[model samples]
Target: MPDGQEVHYGDYVQDDRVHKAVYADQAVYESELDNIFHKKWIYIGHESQVPNPGDYWTTWVGKERMIMSRGSDGAVHVLYNRCPHRGSLICNNEHGNAGKAFRCPYHAWQFYMDGSVRQVPMKQGYDGVIDYKDPQFSMVRAERQGNYRGFIFASLSTEGEDLETYLGQGARAAFDDICNRSPQGEAEIVANCFRIIQHSNWKIFLENQLDAVHPSITHHSTGDAAAAMQKKYKDKTGDDAPMGYQFLADFTLPFEKWDSLQTVGFPNGHTQLTGYMGLRPRDPVTLAHEAALTDAYGAERMDEILSTNVHHVIVYPCLSVQPPLQQLRAVRPLGPNKTLTEIWHFRLKGAPDGIYERALAYYYHVNSPSTMVNADDLNNFRAIQEGLAMVGGGDWVSLHRNAGQDTVDNGVTHSVTGMSEMPMRNMFAAWKQFMTEGN
Candidate 1:
């Protein structure tokens, strides 16, 4: 791009095999920041994160630091963190209640939650040098921003489809599964989250979200340990183990079951992995939660909502969600081989506290950075990046498993089997389009 040279994406991304350079090259990384991450709708913090007026959460859109804030009017706003005067960060911390205004740490330039300049210090200093009335002096907002089901997104580029259109049905189904479980038909964000910096390309993390092949192979030890613990608990207490242990034990499920599960890839690179492990076990706590849902929406609707099993949803290159468990991960690509993922879980607003506790257990044991499950996945991602650095390790990574057997209807790609590589190929198809089409 620097020399006006064309990037033949086909060289790196074939139908089934992707070249290593796409994951390792610095130039490719720069191009991704420009063409993919910046242009596409990237996930920001949820609306519940900054519920109170003047409350703000700091985040990133591509490499640029950003702030998501709630205004006095109760409207959510996203803005670049930089002060227009000297380009210093307005909110230095991750998130905090800026009660009245966002006063710059570098200087006293103040800004409203909506990014308009509330006041500029020493108005006489720029009498002739600048136009004080111009909106340019205020914080720069993202070119476009939208929220769907309380999830917030911001795009640096002014172009592209609206957020709802971009999310497609697969992603919409995920949000519905999450929200419909709550009697109030909404979910609230849990304050704290686990932040992990994975040493691999960002795309690799998204690819692994719906990948059903790696769980049994990479997480075998963790699965066995959990299963053993579960057995020990049942034998000693003469009662079934908690759902937490069962969650990990399911990872040891045979490949046949994984293959039976379905994977659907939607447009704009979003994809979904159908539910495998049954989550709706009958118990006192679960029954109470189900009763609450039933009361809110009646038996028939509650049955339809509870029966929709969604294991995972990847809102391509930005967010990975487990709507059934009320957890999602937001990805931030720091460099070619470095990615920051924030794992956040939610509480079903009107459901019983026990349900939130169940979600908490999954958040801690499965997605947390210290957990064996996530650690194993991170190690594999790093290893793949490291291997790509080796000259003789081969040039392309294969996505040939059941590649041609996928079904395509109405622009959606449905894998013939859950273990098929259709998800990877589908994502690359999007990657190639986002890179080549508009450039």
Candidate 2:
């Protein structure tokens, strides 16, 4: 769709490294919006966010505005927000009950919750000039729509794999990890979410999520402060600091420890980071929650479930999910150097209140707009955006650390070193494939 000089995929992304233009060039980003995002099953909204009939939430699928709404018949539909007539936004609000039908504000053209045309004023206005009965006159829907465990996604193109097949094992496992933890076998979205539009490319945030080396280096101050407070609390009260401190303090972990952890680069550009947080802390609240999980699933099954230790997973091109902590950040790229992230945390249904509190702390302290942890990351992302735009700066962004040490099997790459650039390389590989082969 974008036919510009720099849209050539080979020039920017390579086997082990990429050009800075991949992040800095407007042409490259536009190509991604068409080739990758529109062609693939981009995440739209969660079904849980619009549980009841007539509920709707507006979001973006690539550069196109979309509305994920539940119909009166209780079926979910992902429709383009544009009205068929004159291209006015069909659902203007971020989220609301469309009630019986969606009435476009521009012409008052109405459509059902499922996006079928219901009413248009003055049928005589376009008797022979337009075919009102044509399907094109209706509120247009996406080429494909999918719902996986309550998470919804849409594809603007008819080609490519079904969502389940597209996500593959690793990306699907990220959702499984979140769902399996709840005593009710579900995670419910909290009432609200935090949204921040960063001054950098969307890929930068997703890359940083699995970049083990940067956390300790970029967030050293916040980490050090939390670590110091933990010790001070121990000295003052003869008790360990609260679990919340560990949220910030983990960034102070030595490079040796970071290297000891494992990172799996899955097919389709997805990647996972293991061993950042020791999530299953033995405490009164956690013990109570464990009892609930154990009761829901037998002891052996509970152990089998809890034994799957994953800190975070990058759901390539769309989401960064921390299944263990019940949080997910969705990436929406606005331009080459601007990105919007929706920060949301979920409550494991049927778990204790204290367990939710633990999750709440992580959401507010680490992901919120006001937190120093996020501020630090924002600072660096902005700085990199500015630096890459410079004329004479270095051409390449290195993904060379542990470059040759990664092992590949069945299209997935496994990192020999925790801080390996395997994830970046893996993503670019997927990027290359998507852009070139259109798969």
Candidate 3:
């Protein structure tokens, strides 16, 4: 195809494989910003990030800058960051308290936390020329917004399924599992998050989250070193290594072990991987945490909550959640070849301090930008992106691993093998629907 030619999106997607242009083409990337990110329910910041009235945080939805603010009435609002008067950004900092109103630095135009126009300077200058009371003069809010638990999401389209329905069971379980572990049945966001810009397409990051086959191969060195430290610690001090060491050592699990696990695909591209990590060891920290939950709810209910087996959930096209680790990475596409990911971890309210420390250790050990596990994955992502952009190498990327072997029941798909590419296929299916049908 020639440059600037009108491309049919359906031609690039198939049942088993997808064309490389879907990951490399500039046109396809632009279409995605409109069809998927703008129309779908994209995750905004958590409600706890802006707990107090007039507090605000700035984030992105597709290419637009957005603000998540806490209003005086104790409701969360998602609004455009732009000032209506001169098109200036209302909040210049990433996050801060705006007191009672946001005063634009450009012309001192003020607006309330909920984006209602509050005061205008020199009102007599345009007495009958323009009505300042019109909505156009105030900052614009997202077309629709919804909250699940404490997490928030906003959609630019007026029509679509509600947030919970869009999330389906698989994605909803991610949030529920995270909150249920706390005695208070809630999770709060830790202030600030690690941000990384990867030289790869946004979809590539989502695909890698549930790839299942790459961890043992890619992070082999890191896992081996951690395992060695575990043995050395036991031999010298006669004590078991910290849980942080086990976090990395788990990456050394053989391919057969990974294949024994299961992956499930739900509607609208949501997918989940069953937990493989042994998180329920009889350590003192674990016992104390379990006791707190058991006190809040009975023993049987506490066991049910702790026994929920889930490792990771992909909230298609936007979020990669690890409910077990209390970590979430939000995807933001900068271009066809560049993507930004925000790494956030939550603290389970009313849980033992040791439990929170375990989550923090995983945050720095496995998910942090400096960790070897992420470094290995980042190298592969950039390499894959570079390979796809080249001509004459190949036209399609194979997703044939256990493709036709998946079983479907009540609109959910279960892979025959853990290494199956069903999750990738499922995401592209949703992508094709959004691109071709404009849903």
Candidate 4:
């Protein structure tokens, strides 16, 4: 509607800003689904979610419904969830076992875990007219799929860079860091997730992920309250601060401190904000966990693993990963202004129970919908959506903070300051390329 096609996206070079219409435009949303979501390698679900054969998880790649399941052969497959007959969804539930075969509830047509046709009931109805062995009757598998570690992704378009080539160096760190935390070099889903439907464009949610400037402002009240409670507890007991309280207080980190941090922009739309939460305190629980890590990985390797400083890694258009906290939120855009985010946490395999509990604490306290931290961010997202809906309000959003200060090295852009809008610019750079280029 805003002549987004005529707007040579590259021509909108601003010292520190972009047109606000990019967030609210319906045409832009459609184009994004076609170009970015369809063309890029979109994350589906972790391979571990469907560990056993016949286990499947239904998810979205843009608006398409797909089932990510483990076949009887133990290989992961992505299949369109639609039944070949009548176009009914074969898998109704979000995730469950198909038990060696998936049967369509409509006509009772059965399919194997790999989407191969297994049986068709009422065989005599069309014996001569129809061919049972035809691939058309089978559930369609995704054209391309690739896995990095145990995280699985599928591309709708057949032509593009393979998963590893597309991820480049920047996006790989998200999965690598999460896995390396464990002494055994692995992590597993904590089972189930907190699914939140947000009243905002998906991009609005992603933009906030690496947005270093907003926490101190948007979450100030929540952080301030948590900090006060922490001080009071310390005053009353003369004991150490609670980890939960400190987690919330992290939102109130000084602006300069935030500015001192770094958010890296990668080749694709992937981006990461780097800063350690100081999670490892001298408390017995922490020290014990450290000792376990030291015992398993030795002192130097253990320290390196424990000292990995990653606040958030955003695999653009879909995932926001807080690897250090074993937390990830996957964004599924449903409409121009509707997004569903699946909030999931992971346990470092073989890690201490206390460490796992720490991850769970952060999962519920900071990332869950019930938490003040999340509520505050959601409110901002909704407000931005409403503001962008205004007809006469504005044309562009500003990504100007330290805009020109970012330096690109080896194709990765590094922010001069933590609050730099480099992350937004970096994502849009990828967005423009995906949208305008056919490949």
Candidate 5:
């Protein structure tokens, strides 16, 4: 249907705008999967998801099904989820303990947690027919895998920059900020996560993550209602309303306030938005958490850790991390017009229960599929997909907001205004490079 012609990345991507075909063309989407997701460091499940030997969580890397398993030796292994024998999926459920090894439900061919061949059913039948001990008979391991803090990422291709070099300072700060907040300097994933199938391209979701201008307009109703209720509750009870109300109310912030914030973009497409939420309150729970942090890390260190003002960090092409809130959303592109997002929340290892509760509140109130905030975003994503598919109105999606006004320092670009489209432009620049260079 695409005239059997190759889609040129340069023809579609421009300095301040990109063609809608990038979002709606099947060929472009397939190219993105091959050139970007498969080649880049895509996030797998967190190490905490499989804390014990034989524990595993299934996820996707590009179009490949993958398993993140903890081996008996206390090492985490990323393996192809497909069984070597007959090529059936080894783990059907999202996550479960495989006990000692993974056995293919189809053929009973067993593989170790580290993806080494353990046993083959009826080995005598294949004595001369095939060598079951060959590595080919074992579940294939990922070409490259790395962990930052507790988060795990795997690249299908062996070639490319190492994980740390790829992450750069901006993305590294995401994990550092989250883990450093805890007294134990560690964070653990919650048992389960919220999975969403957004009816739009994955890039739309990522673009919205740092889009400072859309919140006050797209979420105006929800924010206004929450702010009104916050006042009503305060007037009635003579006390501050719960943080949940404040979370929604913050979206009603004026455009000037949003513009005052700063967004920084890295060469690798990672971007960060300065924090807008007041996370450090003088409440009893906050004070208790601060005391615990101060005891673990001296008073000055605690202040420095808590003072890191980052609201969201996009580990481009894969994860959108809100370090301050302990929230991460991983994007899996299902198709040109479909995307899957896995929403996960983390708990500070030695933080006060109230701190975890606060993260939980944000998770349920903002990130969960049932929340109005998420629903609004989902609706917009679907609408955007539908609109981009049309041929009449416009072929280009504008990224002209505050264009050419960004400051560049040492290869990183800093937006002059938070409302600038620097993040989107930064991402598309990386997209073009990845698509054209096949990196």
Candidate 6:
């Protein structure tokens, strides 16, 4: 487990498997909410989403309603989205600029963009009863907030590791890669996101993110169909097929090649699988994109940036981030069995038109609701959850593949084979720490 000075909760979890109750027990789920979601810093939204003062977006840390917004003075603040006066929600909309401040719709109690109390209509009524200037009467801000590059995260608990420490070595390069590709070194949230509610445990989705062994099986049909279409398109046009088509087909990559890929298990339950998608086609748009990247970061740096082969980085417990495609899926656990995942994609700030188009295509085709790829995964997750809930199910879930073979260096674990269960083990390792720590 992690060698932090603080007591480790992960000692209870064994290396190769975890107790089945971790998934099906309500008490464990509640504990996870308190320890993992409440204690750890969670990604809310980018500062770019609310670039202007008064702009806010509402999200969650467990069941707690939280808002990330830009204050009047331009600093970003993450606050609980509840009105202190009567517990009315301060911000009802998913995202929008509040003009200057937030006004609760139910009671009309207002708060500044920074969550400070602005007005109380019945202040005279409370003049003799209570002190309005007290912190309890003001809208509550998140206990701790931090940002990495442009990505912002908030922690409900005042204790525990800071954001940089929490991200450890597993922080997504997609942020640095995307933002640095721009002349200004920044990326902005483009409007809203595509939200999805999965009828399964949130862990299922997180575990699948770095499971290099699943795509070729779960998405084989979509991949085979895309491969067929890709070949047909090239045969007729006598030129390279569109990258998106090949991107879909690559889902059916041969087992041997899939096994050869690598999954890196970083500290704090974060894990990443490397293998770049073959999305660069020899088309006018792609050529233009290459030129733009070369112009912005120079050819050597551009090659280094584009050559980054990260497929997915599972920021354990809350997010599955695909930085290469500017994609993030924020996990919200609804119950022991139900979870909601918000699928969001971003445009690289100051990048070329074709670059954004490539990301958008992947978003729509692979991650979007209409995609067969997503539907297949959702169905599998639901089935797995149902199976796990059964009385006849096994007591422990296995993560035994290449379990003892993982090599550790500087607290990071690298699976010897792509099919290794190192990702799952690494996550459970953190889970144990979170669940058992300080209890």
For model 3 the local lDDT of residue 197 reads 93
Clashing pairs in 6: 9-432, 9-433, 9-436, 9-437, 10-432, 10-433
Computed on alpha carbons, the lDDT of every model, listed in order, comes to 0.89, 0.87, 0.92, 0.85, 0.92, 0.82
Error of 6 at 346 (Å): 1.3
Q: Which stretches of candidate 3 lie over 4 Å from their true place?
A: 1-6
In model 4, the clashing pairs are: 16-399, 16-400, 19-396, 19-397, 20-395, 20-396, 20-397
Tens digit per residue, CA lDDT, model 2, 1-439? 1236435666577667788888988877888899988898888877888888889988887789999989888899999999999998887788889888899898888898888888889878988898876898898889999988988999899988999999999899888988888889888998687999999999899999988999889999999999999999999999998777988999878999889988898878989988567777788887887899899998887887787878889988999999988889999898999998988889888989998898899998898878979899999999999998776857788888998889989877899988888888988888888878853
Q: Please provide, for model 3 over 1-439, each residue's C-alpha lDDT reduced to its tens digit, 9 standing for 90 to 100.
A: 4235767888788899999998899988999999999999999989999999999999889999999999999999999999999899999998999999999998899999989999999999879999998999989999999999999999999998999999989889989999999999999999868999999999999999999998999899999999999999999999898888999999989999899989999988999989999988898889998999999998999999999999999998899999978999999899999998999999999999988899998999988877879998999999999999999887889999999999999989999888999999988888888888853
Question: How high is the lDDT of residue 379 in model 3?
Answer: 92
lDDT of 6 by residue, 13-100 (tens): 6878776667776777888999899889888888888889988999888989999989989999999999888898888889888887
Lowest-sum lDDT 10-residue window in model 2 = 1-10
Predicted candidate 4 versus true structure: per-residue lDDT over 1-439, tens digit per residue: 3455466544443446666656777877787799888878999988889989999999999979999989888999999999988899999999999897999998899999989889899889878998977998889988799999888999998999999998877788899889888877888997777899889989888888899889999999989999999999999999967578899998999988998999898988899999748877787767876777788889898889878888789987789998888898999898878999988999888778888888888988987768889898888889999898788866667777887889989888999988888888898888767767763
In order of appearance, the predictions have TM-scores of 0.97, 0.95, 0.97, 0.95, 0.97, 0.93
Residue clash pairs of candidate 5: none
Better of 1 and 2 by TM-score: 1
Indicate the residue-level lDDT of 33 in model 1: 93
Candidate 1, position 157, lDDT: 90
Model 3 has an lDDT value of 0.92
- Number of clashes found in candidate 5: 0
lDDT of model 1 at position 172 = 80
Q: Which 10 consecutive positions of candidate 3 have the poorest summed lDDT?
A: 1-10
Candidate 2's C-alpha runs over 4 A off are 1-7, 124-131, 234-240
Specify the highest-lDDT model's number.
3
C-alpha RMSD values across all candidates: 2.0, 2.4, 1.6, 1.9, 1.7, 3.6
